[model samples]
Target: MSQTTQPLHFARQPHPSPVAPEQRAELLRNPGFGRVFTDHMATIRYTEGKGWHDAKIEPRGPIPMDPAAAVLHYAQEIFEGLKAYRTADGGATLFRPEENARRFQKSAERLAMPILPEALFLEALDQVVSIDRDWIPEGDGSLYLRPFMFANEAFLGVRPSSEYLFIVIASSVGAYFKTQADAVSVWVSENYTRAAPGGTGAAKCGGNYAASLVAQAEASRNGCDQVVFLDAVERRWIEELGGMNVFFLFEDGSMTTPPLGGTILPGITRASVLALAKDKGITVREEPYSLDQWRADAASGRLREAFACGTAAVLTPIGTVKGRDGEFTIGNGRSGARTEELRNTLVDIQRGRAADPHSWVHKVF
Candidate 1:
């Protein structure tokens, strides 16, 4: 799909009842994931014939939806997640926002939704970040941005909706995990699989996540922090966690992660970690890793470290893997040296403490 010819011009409609500085400060002190929201939100409407229009920054509140909305019935929706970081110089920036935009476009295509122009996507990010700059917390915290689109047309038909709503909202969030040193344990879900061939596995859609909730609940019930899914067909190859991609670090300074063969979400953080590893002269491979092989390697001391990567968790070390077969500890059940090194490197680049050779940091101030 191609971009619309008309340029987007966002109209400003400030929130009348913004939070006071002291109250906002209290919320920012411990924003905790998606618990806290900013004062305003960015929105744009799209019609089949009129294209995207009526771009505006408005107050954060409930969206009016018809009881028979298309999204409510058919689930034509997609979203993107990225964060705005607080720089060392008292400024703010985004980490590879264009990448998120491109992924959003891909997701829209897979779900038969309207393709939002990349320029407009970036502009939406800028508009929200600029308006809620103070919502960005200091130190280890940042403003988490969630841009999503859904079918708003009130219809009962099983086709693409004629009307859609695209919105960008911001939340001040602290680290996902309480401590970086504490590695998370994962449970292997033998009864469920995440995606299959020709499925919406690679797309950042809501349905994919909604379907994984049961398995995630299973993980929590099993005394685990996360769930790891295997391939659908053979049910042997390791796919990924519920929302994050998996990685295996070998003792020989080599890294391997499941290949993206239409069965895995191409995470921006995953790509960044691969690039960072290669830059450090570490060998990185994208290939299928079997669950049996993972167990054997960890047992035999071949696998040195394992971690999951995503926007929210960043890079989290997978210290232990528990399954129906058995349980095994990886690298003393703690975060390894390479995992710590790579995590620090990425955080440094995001926070402007190190040189950005790839120009991934977009300054918003």
Candidate 2:
């Protein structure tokens, strides 16, 4: 699939009455991530007979769909998350968005849906971000972009629907971590599993996150910020968090994380971190690190730090890991040096402060 752009005409409509500047400023003061939205969104449609067509950039508002939509009943859906950065030179750029497009196609195939062409997906995202460039905030803020597709055909059968809709929305978001980037407490989910061996665990489908909400709630009740799901079969190996991937840095200058065992999301951030680690001459291992090993290593002073990475939180240090039995503290209960180094390096590259050695940044304008 070529990355060249095709001139797809968009039907535009300015908001009849956009939020006043003062009101918008007040909201942007904190933004609080994903709570506030821009005034416009991009949309497109696809059908069995007609491929992806009727692409348009329209006003930001509610969508009109039938009550018996396939998404509501059968839950056939997929989505992707990426950010648009406001460069120091006032240029707008996207972070590895082509990777997101490829992942979205994989997600569609897993959900038994039609794959959106790479060119079409990238064009939609570019148009949306460019139109809403004013909404991109300053000082570590971003224009959070969500591109999702759902089965829209009004059908009741258990088969895949013939009609589908893909839409991209932009939201002005502040830091995902409200305060300082402190370590978050994580809980071990004993009663539930996020995915099975031969399940849709790796796909970025809505159902996988939906299934994790309860476990997340359980973690919250236990005074934790996120839930760590164990392997479905053994229930001993660490898998991933509710929405991010996990990593561990050892005292011997080596690091490791759980391997992609067909039950974990292949996060773009995770892949980038691995590449960065290799470039930095750090020995990295992708293997199954179990809970017992985590506790043993922490006690033995071999495990130095633990953190989770994703598009939303960029990077967050893990302070404590608590389960039914007890809790384990890591790195003096704070973000460690190695963790901060990696986080800062990645963020610097992303926010245009440092050179993007990986050529991961894509200029949107």
Candidate 3:
């Protein structure tokens, strides 16, 4: 985790056969989510004694991997997701990328992976965005940035790998949800748990996501947009969605979210929403919320709104929730006014269309 080198200097290797402008434009018209990629990517190597070195921004392609790479066997991999938006000023900006960098460090620590320097992390993202700026879509679209690392040492071992690879890739994406629904329906998962105490649930690793796939599929089968996981111990306390954090808004103009107790991802957007809520004079609390209480409060008209927040979706209102026990709807089963207000406020700042009192947006171009 210690850096023996001064700083990373990325070498450039432009794409020999970059996508033609007409084809790129056609592709950008519907880049979807993570399906479309830019022309180049940022990469760096880490060794046991050399720290980080051989950094480069090269043509987008694959790196050959040995069959027994440590990452393949041990699953020591971490990743981060953020976005770069095209502002009205004809430039691109990133939303709280430094926060992503810090969280990446924390994820690395939890996964027993190498701690990439925060500055180097930021620089890597900047280089990737700077080179692939054209890939950024217009309107509500954005360039999704994915920063990842994995153990590459070609050995079958139980301990940490001495060699690793870090890379950054970008994709042009539209709305996360394919549908234009005002709110998304959710399914409560009682049979499966997303995380437990002293586990890697808080980490942004591949394993946690891979484990959630089955539950997610269950949600899909149940006719829901996302799956909500409860606490492993009680199986009733509301924890989070498969990939997002949860928030409960009360009629008393207050909101509460599950506290970060090493079982949640500690989302960057979640923190920003809390700060924005406080700024708007809404009382915000970080505490435990039980599923039973959520149902009761919703039924009693105390819970005005509920939403999920994450880097990808930003803020998605939870209109209806269904489980084996029963089903419940939040506040008319539509996006609440307060929810819209909060999302608009956050999006305005992200798109550089409003005041940035918190300085969360970083200009990349």
Residue 184 lDDT (model 3): 96
For model 1, give the 10-residue run with minimal summed lDDT: 1-10
Q: Report the Cα lDDT for residue 96, model 2.
A: 92
- Candidate 2 on 1-365: residue-level lDDT in tens? 12223445667766778777788778778899899998888898887866777888888889999999999999999999999999999989898999999999999988889888888888899989887787888888899999999999997999988999999999999877654637888999989999998899999999999999999999989989899999999999999999999999999989998999789999999999999999899999999999999989988889999999999988899989999989999879899999999999998888888899989998997
- Output candidate 3 Cα RMSD: 0.9
- Overall local distance difference test of candidate 2: 0.90
* Per-residue lDDT value at 179 in model 1: 46
Candidate 2 versus the native: TM-score? 0.96
Using lDDT as the measure, name the better of candidate 1 and candidate 2.
1
Q: Quick one: ranking by lDDT, best first?
A: 1, 3, 2
Better of 2 and 3 by lDDT: 3
For residues 1-365, could you state the per-residue lDDT of candidate 1 as single tens digits? 34567888889899998999999999988889999999889999999888898999999999999999999999999999999998877789999999999999999999999999998999999999999999999989999999999999998999999899999999999978654557999999999999999999999999999989999999889878899999999999999999999999998999999999888999999999999999999999999999989999999999999999999999999998998887999989999999999999999999999999999999988
Writing each residue's lDDT as its tens digit, candidate 3 over 167-187 gives: 999999987877678899999
What is the C-alpha local distance difference test score of each model? Answer: 0.93, 0.90, 0.92
Candidate that scores best on lDDT: 1
Q: Which whole-number lDDT from 0 to 100 does residue 200 have in model 1?
A: 98
